[model samples]
Target: MSAEIKQAKCIAVLGTGSDVGKSVIATALCRIFSDRGYKVAPYKAQNMSNNSGVTPEGLEMGRAQIVQAEAARIAPHVDMNPVLLKPVTQIGSQVVLLGKVHKDLSAAQYHREKEKLWDTACGALDRLRAPNDVVVLEGAGSCAEVNLMARDIVNLKMAAYAKAPVILTADIDRGGVFAQIVGTLACLNKAEQDLIAGFVINRFRGDIALFKEGVEWIKKKTGKPVFGVLPWINHHIPNEDSVVIERPEAKTDPVKTPTVLVVRTPHISNFTDFDALFQVGGLAVDFVEHPIDLSAYKAIILPGSKSTRSDLFWLVKTGWASKIQAYVKNGGHVLGICGGYQMLGTKVRDPEGLEGPPGDTDGLGLLLLETVLKAPKTTTISRFEWDGIPGLGYEIHMGRTAGADRIALGKKSNDGLLRVKERNQQACTEFDGAVANSGRVMGTYMHGFFDSVPILKKWLSLLGLNELEPPEFCGPQGRDRQYDTLARHFEKYVDVAAIVKVTNID
Candidate 1:
């Protein structure tokens, strides 16, 4: 038989360390390539994360890949995330199959499954490249980990399989950018090192002119192009930190004399959920570190938390539970979402101790319901509405609530429990049998609840906050436009054309 050859033009984006802006840069590159009219796709072979998203096909994958695909203007594929590990316990994770939790396995067991995942990852890349000009693959953590080099699906193996060029990015802001780049290359095997085409120094704050010597030194040592020395700009981009968005530039408007005391629990997920209320017309918002007098704030918002049981335990330990109950008794508004929703119930059953489980435990006794942590989390995007209020948003969680069915406030969700359903139904109209109680407290499992600008404005107007206005921050083009703006900013210093030429793609 004649030898078969695959011509899949791809590139691997590797970072010196975690949170070094690899995701942002990858997204930016996707936008840049897509803007040039290329059929481009983004891929990540494996991801270990708790923040996840539901794809169009009612499956789940790392939320990062979803954001990247959006930047690429393509629908998310399970192949992008061939192997996903969502932490179910401290030492174990739920292995996801194409975006749905397939099995619960420990770290050891999952590592053993990497070889199988390589096939899946390679398949995804092939499919993506079939109709595309390029596939931008993002690597996980540091590619320099010698021990992990063998099992690595992201950098070395992915580069070899896709036969793609590589760009190693080092965070100058983290210091020792030189050492990171040089050390990484030094640690890699001959073949791995050969794959790297060049290096880029990201998140460079202060004067670039002053860093000329440093850049030159790196170029001389590595014998590669210094693609760019990007400066830090306060871009109000939606962050990858699902737990929190960068606190809005420390508002100077008198702190708004927060009328609501929002408790920011450790391990808080979906903190961005309340950005609307913070940006609400007249309502003042302040975060309380340790439980303080709740009598001042008009409402208490319990945002989503990653470790609900652990956070609830913290609330109990810090006496916030009693204080919250007292505030509610005094007619204060209390709200919860997702894990927070689970906390407002009667009891939380974690019989498997998947979430620090020894047994079931009682809740704050606010709502007459019970939550059970079960296999296969409920992750979905749907439109839900209260009997009298409008709703729009997505849902992500691992617990199911029971009891108080009649007392539930909204309509049953047309969507599945943990995946995005078809768009035949409007957003925020499917309530999943949960609705707003016209009493002292209200709760639901919805994430991104305030994304609907009009709905949020209406909700805030009902609370007598009429002065708040949503920022028309981006142009009508949404994130793509903003990404281009960022790209243009990078282009000022980066060899934008050279990067494309090096990759030999659009």
Candidate 2:
């Protein structure tokens, strides 16, 4: 290390378990520090998530880092999230090294390359630290996994490397708050224990005052401070993990409300695509795993998938395909995004065995479209318009679709659903997506389709749900509001001043 060169004071937010509000806490801290006039950056050495996003530089990174960057009021960069592991199968994941596709590897295969990944992660962290006043580092899953601790690049190992103060965040809402904290500490050595400056009890429900003794006990037992007990808040903040969608019943009942059924495919990817729709009042969004009566729902959304072919097979096996086809026949609207969009065609060909074995699978044949799964995944920030109603979104797909415009259905809105004006910040007149069967069936390669208020409103009008719609922003401004809300929530409950002091940053 150079004498004059200084690295940013890093704060490591490690979790007791996955989805323990680590990402949200890190995001809140990012906004809090940034608001205090510090140049704050969020870093995650590696993130295993199907929920990923494209950066302004046209690079792919975990969406969690993107959310934290937005909270910090900075443009998201690839360095913020250097390594992303997107799960394609139960045992295999498509490794994305520094914002580019690397290779698909199984669990054992991935661990073998951990050494190289660790070095890259460290280099990226050093770069991020060099220019920032403070960097908020987030950990993946439980930090005290004894078996995998040696190869852990994003948790305790990374925290120790940066010499950062770790805030061990535990979820109280899941119960066993004491066991969660104490058991985690029992697994770590004294040196690792010293790195943990304090704790944050996340998702604490009911009266926080009642938990004062609980906090005191944690401090007494561990000899470390309990910084705060974060309240259980149900906010519009988007989740970066697929775990949120695991319980399909979390949202309102599809049968009772004017609901939208999102077919929960086994390999569902980018599940956050429908968060905007979930916010609309008087409307419910339900992820139904099994086939159901589609007569009550206004629309059906087939979301993006990691294994499109596999999920397609599941759709058929689970009887969802027949139900969807019947729904479409009964004048139901079906909109597919990304991999889902690829499945709405007449046939899908994978000659090079990219998606699976080199073969052909018959699509739903809802449109005059055929697709070929190819290499070099399309990941770009896109600007487009739906019938002149402009919108902004991104694309991440591995298939090329051939929608024949010559063969059109009479008296139906056929062909491209979006007229693209630009892609990857470059100007080009291009049409994307396909629509057929009287505008009831539409498919687009673009994600974040509902983020644009105008486009959302237009769709609502088409579905006759415009009158029941609620007001909520979905882009940068909307996210900023949520960030501010989160910061405020933390400030109200947590000891913000003490956290700053722990960082020791001037």
Candidate 3:
């Protein structure tokens, strides 16, 4: 490595705009460097997404970093992502610092508090960089938003703070690759531009030779090396935002395989929980928002949400509530998870105005239970049993639910007859959600319910699809394989030697 390169130990993957594959590139680099026997760690000063997962220590961080951590063959820690902004409203978000809820702030309020948050972010970065040979830093959104640059703590500012060379990534699939690279550089001041070491063009299709002139243009225009032109990789990488769900591709016929539809709520959270189902061979999972005929699908899943009450309000307003009710009434299997579980209850009480206004909202009334939004959010990596089958999952929610009526229970208890047992290091007898007497509808607080192979098999059988074979790998193991596949694909296209030189790795 060059003498100047040896001074740097971290490399920041900044993007020209949001969803331009910064996370994907960072993850690839983490795995690529890790494969070279370097002690690597992934770092993100701040992440704004509802797609999050709890660590083994019960601490929470964005799922993207968690995937990156796994790619680096390391345990995920909250310090990797010091600040997590979960948007609960259009203008406001629930800020999480060091895996705990710091506060809820509006956009302007959050900017005003950037100094304190910046210190925390820097401290986290330092801790991550101290032990690892290389810390792959991922930036948020565009690095050159002039209006937000003064208060920005996640992009070029973070790169400067960490003394890391920046690798700008742009998605060619979005078109205007040249404009994105040149325009972003034009927006940056000279000092900021100096931090950039190179650029990577992502999601390119067709012939690489055709893009030779394009690459030369960027290099000539910006005086930065075009590290690589990554082809559009068709892989199952967990998404960091809900925007992908909004523009899903057209669905196909299930054709003897079981079909499942997930109610795509307005404020969906932890949607990656369904990734396991997507990998199964004989299952078709689709996200549906508008009212549609649910009779074709074997099961309908109500996914976790950041704002349960408001999403439930949207469900009712958009006519999905009545549609789901009719589907379930017609013997269609329905599974409610987390916020979805809360929405299935008789009422949801938010007296502290935690989620929204302090009041009660009418639920879908599918389950005879009531949920009360309370303090001390529950975050745990739980081992549980579903219908006598072993299951593993995590819980991240903001409320406690109980049976609404004792007489309605009949032979069942307040926890209902679904019979779920959760173990968190210590074996504790705790009940989660309820199952209807009809046995067609079930609800649970666990997010990764479908990850359990036995449980998934049983659920498929319940949906009348018993001929399909179980996937060889599911859950964590399956995800690890995906990371490796991603690394190999990028390794073939990306300039690993250049990246190593940039990181000062000898």
Q: Which candidate is the best by TM-score?
A: 2
Checking candidate 2 for backbone clashes, the offending pairs are none
The per-model lDDT (C-alpha) reads 0.71, 0.88, 0.86
Candidate 3 Cα deviation (angstroms), residue 484: 1.1
lDDT of 2 by residue, 309-403 (tens): 88888888888888888899999899999988878888887888987799988888887787777788889999999999989999998867865
Q: Between the candidate structures 1 and 3, which one is better when assessed by TM-score?
A: 3
Residue 25, candidate 1: alpha-carbon lDDT? 79
Candidate 3 global lDDT: 0.86
Tens digits of per-residue lDDT for model 3, 1-506: 66532322889999999999999889888888888898999999999999898888888899999989999999999999999999998999999999999999999999999999999999898888778888999999999999989988999899998889999999999999999999999998899999999999999999989999999989899899999999988777787864548765327464455778888888988988888788778778888767777788888889999999999899999999999999988888899999999899889989899987799899998988888888888888888777678888888988788875642342224465344455446566777788988888888888888787888889888888888776777787877788899999888888888978877767
Q: Which pairs, if any, clash in model 3?
A: none
Residue by residue across 1-506, what tens digits does model 1's lDDT show?
Answer: 99765455888888777777777778888888888888778888888776666676657787778777887889887877877876656778777867776777887887888878778778777877877788888988888888888888877788888888888888888788889999999998888889898887888888889999998998899888888888886554455453233342222233345465567776566565665555444566666657676666666778787678888888899898999888888777787878888888888877677676458777787877777776567666565544345454666777577574522442233432222222324332233423335455767787766666655665555545567665443211345556677767777877878888888874
Candidate 1 matches the true fold with a TM-score of 0.84
TM-score of each: 0.84, 0.96, 0.94
Task: For model 3, give the 10-residue run with minimal summed lDDT.
Answer: 406-415
